[model samples]
Target: MSVALPRIDAIRDAAARIAPHAVVTPVMRNARLDALAGAQLFFKCENLQRGGAFKFRGACNAVWSLSDDEAARGVVTHSSGNHGNALAIAASTRGIPAHVVVPEGAVKAKLEAIEQAGAVLHRCAPNTPAREAAAAEVQRQTGADLVHPYADTRVMAGQGTLVLELLNQAGDLDIIVTPVGGGGLAAGCAIAAHALDSSIQMIAAEPEGADDAAQSLAQGSRIAGITANTICDGLRTLIGESNFEALQQHGTQVVTVSDDEVVAAMKTLWRELKLVIEPSSATVFAAVLKRPEQFAGKRVGLVLTGGNVDLEALPF
Candidate 1:
């Protein structure tokens, strides 16, 4: 099960491939956040990225990586929200059709955005197996290229592009933190950051209720079938196989935080940084706040994965 991880060159290629479409996304900072965390915190605001999440980077790369014939046949994938919207928008850019298999209870706003992007939506049970099966059926019928949300190498390479932009913008960072769901962003960041600077540490923040990534890393094996019961809806997925392989290869660290802690952190970011981010994005700050000693006096970079929150349901 030796998975070949995306190399720095592949990330560079992805960056070039997606440059015309993907946003570079700003790296921001707040002195108040620094004071509270006892560290210099740099936030990579992918919430402002097109389609409102860092998922666009991976989705765009995956969509555009296809050959002309593949593009003509179009793309299909299963996503809870952000990735679906991203794939839809990305496919639209190439003037191709996109098929998104979304769970029945997916956020209304996200589903609307996906449809608005002109992608046809297919609904299934809100579980991994059902989602995958529906997406596979779509591909079988439409003769579409299946673009997995996170597991594909092209998607990983696209995600790695975010690290490339972050390191360049933030300069030397001691550590980079991102919330882990399917482990796409974390794996990509780990690969790119380690390639750029071997000493740079990569850390993943996970919801305590969905701590499979943390447990898997600690036990030296992938853990599955744990029911996710966290407020961070976007992070309730089991880690992807290749993504786990990348994390293990890079020796990435994982920290778990409770839903309450995520809410508190989310509130702090909204108040201090004036940013509207989802609970999944808040996990990075929550992790730093939970373990101050780990990041004290260091320059830490946090990826605000998305801002696709339901305005009607404010956790604060």
Candidate 2:
């Protein structure tokens, strides 16, 4: 069965529309990281973006592009954390109400970020079904358009713009690696990278506890029943049906890393690069470190997905 992928031109259009709201975050390249890892490393620091994650780019694009009539109904989403915050901020910018359904176990800091952006918070069970149910109820009550965190094509294309920016700024990447949860970012990466350079390897990295991306790739089917058991909370989602289609079609590389490895990479970034990256973002860095052979001597781009962390309370 052939699957339809989001159009690269639509993604490019989204990049243009969201240019102001979305930060054109820097591409930080290090000869040292390149030497140590045996590859030229260009890090797309979406970690430093507004709302502390790349979710802002998609949320901004989706929110702004909504018709005045459509936006009048407002927007709602089910997010563990970052997407909720991004949507809230985006809605706030458009002078529209945002209703966010988040899991009970979602980080308090993230919840506060959403609330701070003037969105009403609705809490739900931590599972997929429960989250869908809660979001459905919110949509029924608020008449809000459901802007999904990953599954929405607009959101995926918006996220795809990150790779476009990376390629424009850094250029000529042999491989592109990103952390995958619901696969929004990875699918976006694959579409953009492949469009930019058909032969460029697009890779997805996930924490072992949330390694469904890898399993789904290996099994040649969507893997259900994966538990969210990693410190990379942002990567705790199973790949969505559409995301799987993109990955399968693109033949994207999938890699898994341990929580310990994620932590080590996080520490390395903080210590070596002076960047405070989140666990999910570090998953990609860890993948590169763990499997240097795959990337050695190649020009690699690693999307550092976010930097949202509780600095006041960090795990030593």
lDDT of all predictions, in order shown? 0.92, 0.88
- Can you tell me which runs of candidate 1 are displaced by over 4 Å? 1-4
> After superposition, which runs of candidate 2 have C-alpha atoms over 4 Å from their true positions?
1-4
For 12-67, candidate 1 gives per-residue lDDT tens digits of 99999999998989999999899999999999999999999999998899888899
TM-score of 2: 0.97
TM-score of each: 0.98, 0.97
Tens-place lDDT per residue, model 2, 121-214, is: 9988899999999999988988899889999877888899999989989878899998999988888778878887899988889899988878
In candidate 2, which residue pairs get closer than 3 Å at backbone N, Cα or C atoms, i.e. clash? Answer: none
Among these predicted structures, which one has the highest lDDT? 1
